[model samples]
Target: MRGRHCRSGRTGRKRRQKQQSHVDSVSLCHQPQYVRLMRFLHKQGFVSTLLQPALFSDTGRGLQTLKTIKPGQLLISLPESCLLTTATVLSSNLGHYIKSWRPRLSPLLALCVFLVCERHRGEASDWFPYISVLPTSYTCPAYFTDDVMAVLPASVRRRALDQREAVQEIHSSNLDFFRSLQLILSLPVEDVLTYEALRWAWCSVNTRSVFMSHPSNDFLSGQDVYALAPFLDLLNHRPDVQKSFCLQVKASFNNTTRCYDIRSVSGTPHFQQAFINYGSHDNQRLMLEYGFVAQGNPHSVVYVDTDLLCDALKRDRSLDQKIKFLRENDFLNNLTVSSEGPSWRLMTALRLLSLPQTLYHQWKAVLLGQAVSEEREEWSLQTARTLCQCLLQDTCKALDKIFFLLQHCDQLTREQLEVVQALRQEEKCILGSCLEALDGMWGQRDGLLSCQPDVGSVS
Candidate 1:
């Protein structure tokens, strides 16, 4: 959604001139339409949040405090009727058609189909007000053309390509599916299931939906996953900011209705941008899924795919059996390198990968948390450091090529430039940290082996 706030409605009030990054007076006050909407929500018990324009950045719109919101104050609460959950889709007229498939599709995919069909119905759709506010264009990497996605680093590129492939697959499947049902339903195929329209709906759900687990007893959908929280989804994610509230669905007096509630964990200052932490998501995730990136994200990480690690391990013949073992056990994928050296799983895998054939039988026992001698522990740490050093060297070369491309490229969109720049910075920083950690490990290698069992902190 565009900023949680919109630009409209002003009376005879004289407006104060302010910079584009500063909060304008007109936006600080609720607009007429928003006032009307607030009034309507108030009747439904959602009076705490106000849709106010953001102070900084272009097209700024977000929720602002109407009064001094104290800590533990209930920030917002909406009736369950407002949440667009799978239950809504299962109850829709399109539900029967979705159920006609031999093996049922995932709740998310089924919801996508329902959304497209409902959208085609225009004003007749029940959630038109919510749909009307959804942004037409999402800046997520999935929305980017292949050429633009190509400029991104391998870590982001892999994910973007995977998403692209998934979207295409879903689109093709849904197209074939709806076409088969067209005659039975007396509906035009193109009007309901076009790739462009489906893509829009998919992106909207991907970017805006919040995870609100449904009650276990509810039989509507197997997965207790994402739900659209209409106006609440407009708030921008601030990973660095302190969280103001948590969301929940609770039953009303007679348990006849469930209301969506935002219970404040801390007080929000008046006129300040209220933010929700979308979990400790890395920059790649935020950029790929949410269509925006937070500068200086502490959770930022660079991924080291297993294929690269396997290539490096191939040099050591002693690791052959161990590498095969790791792959067979499913521990060879999704390894990550962050500011704090290698991830625990990657480090453990490397430790096992470097173990001598004579001690290979101990791998399972060690993984089961059995105690190992100090010498063995030091050996494992040393082996892990060595493997990471090799990884760092290879990563540096890859980064160098990307750097050169970024320096020489003449034409790039603002979004592409921003993503590339952030990727380069994060990757370089992670590699630099790895190199520094390895150097420290090397310095302590002799001391650790000769004088004491203690190895200096590797992280």
Candidate 2:
């Protein structure tokens, strides 16, 4: 859904550019398209290259600015004692630690510093300039020590230095290195380029939603986030919010339709289906456009515990870093677990598997309260069934909540609304199959009999 529609606009513009360049490469100031061209150049930091008129009249206008949030003026104060303590445990000589890092000053390290700074300041704007200028590839440690770091922006270097020093080091001996680190760390990186100019990643003021990290980079389907960016994660979860608004679905089973609601869960849903079409819910639209909608699905309170995923993640080097970071920083901690509610129990049970709701309902209904039935040897099947019902009910509520959020979504485009409609159809389809499967079971004399419900089309 977010594919062709999102790319067409860019493709069309590129085609139009060929014609525009042939017309008046000069007098760019006078061209209406010049403003947009200038904006693009500014956003990508290509103003100087494209602004040279005599050399090339193709793309002009240099003193352009993007819609990016401005760089933040940061001030993070820690207890002097804590700073002193950190200075001691993290490094013996701030100079040495900075020196140690000298062997490993990768771009990832630099971004980490900038991110920490932004988080400390509590502003997306704080990272705007850094994001625009950050390097994707890093040179060797030797270059970082002699050439790269030395030439970096003074501000960036200063911030980097401060972050290092905060970890604990012999402050007096490493003062000079710390200061140098700060200055060098801030310089605008060289030869940096990106296919997609992240022009800016600002917090959505109107939508009041934000995300921690973009999913397209090096991380897996759901990695790349730092705990400091919790606000960003909530914002990126627009899919979950959108799903809450769905009235029904085209269930995979039996192609049946049934009504669903989103209000079962009490949390405030930020938008509704109608808002997807108004072009106003930019945060939500961003997710849809990026094909990150699946990432934001309304997971009924059911899911696995951190320990399980962590153990699994440890064996894979690719997932290890993200898993460790999330654990160490407690990113998953922000995801609330409702201990005192039915929704919590239901979600917990359902998250265990990726099966349908009707089966879940029947299973949970049988095993939720009763003692282990002695008739059959193993209770695994019964236990599994009970959990399924809990999941089903919770899923229904999750969908209802999404719809509730959608009702308030007054700013999305018409096409986005169509996305919501598609999802609703899917929900109905699922529910219908569940009903059909349950009809035969309802007639069974013994509710807990082994005559399981027939399989449905939905998997």
- Which candidate should be chosen as best, given lDDT against the real structure? 1
Tens digits of lDDT, candidate 1, 14-88: 232123124442352345544554554555565454334334452256666555666666666667767787778
After superposing candidate 2 on the true structure, give the runs of residues whose Cα lies further than 4 Å from its correct spot: 1-107, 111-291, 294-374, 377-383, 407-459
lDDT of 2 by residue, 149-244 (tens): 232222223433443343223223323423444433333222111111111111111122112232332211223322221111111222333334
Clashing residue pairs, backbone N/CA/C < 3 A, model 1: 4-61
The 0-to-1 C-alpha lDDT of every candidate, in the order given, reads 0.62, 0.29
Task: Note each model's CA RMSD in angstroms.
Answer: 9.7, 22.2
Residue 283's lDDT in candidate 2: 24
Stretches of model 1 off by over 4 angstroms after superposition: 1-55, 58-61, 90-105, 121-126, 148-159, 180-188, 213-224, 243-257, 361-417, 447-459
